[model samples]
Target: MSQSQKKIHYAWVVLIGLIVMVGAAKGGIMTTGGLFLTSITEDLGIGMGSLTLYFSIASIVTMISLPIAGKLIAKYNIRMLLVVAVILEAGSFAMFGFMNSVWGWYLFAIPMAMGSVIVTQLAGPVLINNWFKKHRGLAMGIMVAAGGLLGAFLQPAAGNLIASEGWRNTYFILGLGVMAVVIPVVLLTIRMTPQQKGLQPYGMDEVKHNETIQVEKTANSGVTVAIAKKSSAFYFLIIFFLFDTSIAAFNQHVAPYAVGLGYDIKFAGNAMGSWSVGVVIGALFFGFLSDKIGVKNTAISAMFTGLVPVGILIIEPENPVMFVIATGLYGFVVASLGTLGPLLTTALFGNKEFSRIYGLAIMGLAVAGIVAIPTYGYMFEITGSYTNVLYAIFIMLIMNVGAILLAFKGKKKLEKAGLWN
Candidate 1:
């Protein structure tokens, strides 16, 4: 094919791979698995605390796996890695069907967490950074939004399957489905770098002909992983990730919060679905906005917008319409995890050592999973209300805006010292 005929960039193919693979891993497995929680506990006659501890175990594993996953991604074939990742993740999920004891979950949580770190957490950001130089934010947003869109349907479907076929069959079906769909997509579309396809990343026409020049240019604009690890910018990003994850953990408590307010379980599910809608819209909006107004500004706007939902939850929790709106708005802001997080990293440090740096930064997410969820639950247990937790989230939201500003300031210092080069 001539150049004109071959004009469809392969970065988009990689993007499609990312969307399908990550979305399936997240929607098919991670997001919808909660539907099986009550069923599994009830069927197996396990305590809720005992059964749920497996998720905690998975979080700890995820924390330890992030940096190791990053190094492996840098060294291995992207296609092969993702294929193995999906099998481990989805396969273990399928295995959950056969176990009569809670110990099975604890044992399988190891591989589950490992596989998930690669497919769900690492792949989308790393691959997008590799494949798209321009419109990177938009690409990240689309990937995240695709998960939201998929989960919007998948959650309901999983719920119905659990209701009709029992949790065991539903577990097997979801695991098999994810592996069937995601592995093939990874094989077909994913590549470690544009060079493998003899092309440049999207929006890299000016540097298309020279790989050496491309590397040099990008390296000069960013700090190395070593320098970034020692810098305040890095610490600030970690703090931001922590607060972001902690704040968003409130989503898990939303159903309970609603039930506390006298809403039925069905309404809670519907309300959570509304939140998914916000996720889709916000992902796209923040991505496009980051491209237009820049990452820093877009982040500040998100933090400000986040306050609205928290306020609604605090002051008007009983108003069903407002509750849905607030939850949706909160999900919209949560889109930042998929959108702003990576983009901000790139903006602050460039793409020179992006995978390594991002891998380290996201440890905060894993840590939050361990700390935040239990903290929220504990606070509610002690206080008999989410009022304190909501107030704390409000303060964290404000702190997030400050962290963004401080991180940018740290970036300026790095640039001034010529450490970026």
Candidate 2:
């Protein structure tokens, strides 16, 4: 078949590239950080908090890099950027095998965060929008499933690698191995725009060739960024992001927590896999629930689900099976940041200035990571247990409930002011 008449469009090919690159970046490298923590801290005689401070450093770098990444993605070649991004991210992970001190993690976190903000955070959605006009949600769902599925497999494999080869070689293998796989995929199949392939987006067949969604017409009816920034609702949403993300950031500690409770690293790995499974199921469930009920209820429901896991951990994590199941439940809650964050944004302010408003509010995510991850670590270090940490998560879940409530009230104030068109 001719290029235009081919059975599958190049957009799908680009999506294949995205699945490989994102899954490797997220599933293979980033999400596995916790697996190495116990070994590193125990081997080096570093405090868990002191060693995991790298997470805070990475979050800081990510926060600083976010706006710059969005601009760069808009202006640069997506393929070249992704290839380079994987190197910075995975390269840092590989080099961790060479480090002898806490300073090594603190130092390498810079490049890792810079690469991560692009590869894992921004690329999938942006590329999907540029390629799939119809079935956009399905495209995103597919990409998310790739991450969860890959992580499910990789988590246990990573645990086994760490058990056999040690954390050092596991780091090197996972890091360099992923770079080896993802680099070529990005170079070969990814593109910034469908225009590069001389074709329209996949769904354009149903509409006039020249017609595009009237984004401007819809955008004009929502809360403006300037107005949103001034509203109480925006600040409430920021608080919600901070609280919710702090809860999510605990994923990085799951392996350590399991190990601390006398489970082996292999069990921790299996637990992390269950978490990945939860992420997959939770994303689907929240999306469907939101469509059925509303963003507000779905978000509130997310906070409540978090309570179940925390309750289990605090009461009794003695059963390995139950612990894994609880971790999976928390993983379901972890997905809310992705599945509900955007919906909450639109539900509050409409679409008038979504990108800008969300960009600003999501600073809370980075800020939360900077504080929460290390806090969990230090709490473990100081107390010799994660009981206190789990209790704090319980409180935060309650706080998130209040934040969600206040955010809707703030939305009401905007509508009452006649600012909502």
Candidate 3:
């Protein structure tokens, strides 16, 4: 076949491989962490507040490492960087089986956070930006949906494993499993971009001739972090992400909260599993909706839906079914943030310095991790209930809605200034 008529582009294949690698690595750890929290606390005879402090430390490490990771991704080949990332992430997880003291978690959390930053947070968006010029939002949505799908399956499986094998073995098995799956996949299929394979993005051919000509002229005109930072839209976008993520921190404590309310571990796990199911559905739906209704509207709708679960938790639902329904609704909003967050950024600011800008923006998420989870734990430690945390989440939800509205208003200012096309 002639060069232009070659059969396979290979970049799409790489994209699929990344989806699986990221999904398994992230789902196996993040979604499963809460399931193990109760078991580990019981076995180790540690307070939940203290055990949760390890997560806070991890978030602090992640914040410190992000700028360095950003520099590495820009400077190095993606394959080597991802390989190191998976090893750090999975290896740290497996080593958790050996920890008998809180200090062990504090130390291991550093590497785990480092690996997670690369594989879970940075890899997907950077790869999607490199691979697909058109339908980029759809691609990002699918990637995040892949992670939720894995979580939907793996979370329940993790709960079952914890029930059967104990938490230590559970962590060992999952960590090793993620490593076994991700290592070969990254080495075999992950690539930096379509250009590295000498092929164009999959949909480039469908552009109208006039649009095709414009691609070359504007290829270098993508937005940079410097320009993005100068806009008010960027600041409001950060605020939007911060509040959205603070609400999501509730997932880290959902099982514990249920168990604290007199439910069995199995029931708590099943409740969390239901929440994951909502995540799967919401990710796919809101991802598509963001494309149609616009990012600002989609974000506002998500934050608005966040109020449902807080209401249920605060009202202290007597019926188990009501509790499950309310938490499931919250899960849907949380998943929408996963799909919409990056897309909103891309919409507000083009993909010029996408990695750097996104890196900076997700620092808010890291900060939320630092504050929200441990604060929930500490609130429970002090009051013996999650009521205060729920109230705080409700307030953050309201503020998030206002923040997103301000983002759109800010975007108009940027547009008028010729900052965004």
Candidate 4:
């Protein structure tokens, strides 16, 4: 019996594996890293500016690595690469438990960022693109939402652990623990492509049956990498990546933001938990909405929708309930970075050399994080409030609306030039 003809497609198996590995990497390590800010700074007597500066270091490394990582993921053996990535990410994270100086963070930040660049940033999107012929948006959403699901559980638990077990111990336990679980799952489930299982992508049959869609030709169609790189769509994608990532980078500061507002760690933990819940729901929403309403409209609506949370944060952040609500809403906006980033990439550039194009374009994330994360930290440290930061985020959201429209305009130019097929 052919795999695609079975009751379940193998792509679902690939997706399930991604959900576990990416979820663990994102939820257990990446998102949860922010939960340690307050405790680590206070306990170690490190300045907020100094510790968060490590994020800048990490971002720089990620930026430099992304293009190379793109080529490597396309060319390398999937299982080998993923295993090493998890170890680099999780191992570096666990080693944080032993650091006594800020330089330790700076040092480990290198490998950690390298690992996460593959594990957290690139893997799910690349794999889903490879494995799904249709419903790509939904698969991306579900994988991202699963990260949220793990985050919804892990964030609070890590918070409580920090309270009970100390930051060092919590770091070791979470890092090693998630690594332990994720490595085996990656080995068992992830494949570079569906062709490995002697099966076509999920929904390939349906795509072929639909006359207008033109399955094989459509799959082969798209601008070459050189053409895409020179196009206006590429530039707007960089802007979109920058602003969207800048919005999401606020996650690293959310806990500290709450504490600075006079909320305790417990409240901050729950707030992170709320953000995770929003991520799960919002991821699915963006995925479904992108497919139904189109990525451009959905991206525009997301920017406007983001303003509500920023407004609430600016106006009434002191209210405990409202603050958590704002964080949750913020999470919804952040989910777009995961669910919509790749979708937008495909929409603008088509899927040709998607790895390289998407990799190069989303370096804006690295650029944004390097500037934004430490900027947010230093802003709070200097002003003793996130007021300006929230206002800044508001502006970024507005700018992105313009960026999205212009990006599509750029796409039209490519089509007019006879590059895009």
Backbone clashes in each candidate structure, one number apiece? 0, 0, 1, 0
1 or 4: which has the higher TM-score?
4
The TM-scores, one per candidate, come to: 0.91, 0.89, 0.94, 0.98
In candidate 1, what residue range of length 10 has the lowest lDDT sum?
Answer: 206-215
**Measured by TM-score, how close is model 1 to the native structure?**
0.91
lDDT of each: 0.85, 0.85, 0.81, 0.91
Candidate 4 lDDT, 1-421, residue by residue in tens: 4653656888999999999998899999999989998998988899998999999999999999999898889789989998999999999999999998889999999999999999988988989998997899999999899889999999999999999999999999999998889999999999998889987888886553656466787885788889998988899999999999998899999999989988888889899999999999999999999999999999999999999999999999989889889999889888999999999999998887888888899899999989999999999989999899999999999999999999999999999888888
Residue 109 Cα positional deviation in candidate 3, in Å, after optimal superposition: 0.3
Q: Residue 301 deviation, candidate 2, in Å?
A: 1.6
Model 1: per-residue lDDT, tens digit, 309-403? Answer: 99999999999999999988998999888799999888888877888889989898998878876677667767888899999999999999999
What would the per-residue lDDT of candidate 3 be over residues 209-303, giving only the tens digit for each residue?
Answer: 88888886664454678877877777888887778888888888988988888887777777777787777778777877777887778778888
Tens digits of lDDT, candidate 2, 164-199: 999999999999999999998888989887888887
Task: Write out the backbone clash pairs for model 3.
Answer: 223-352
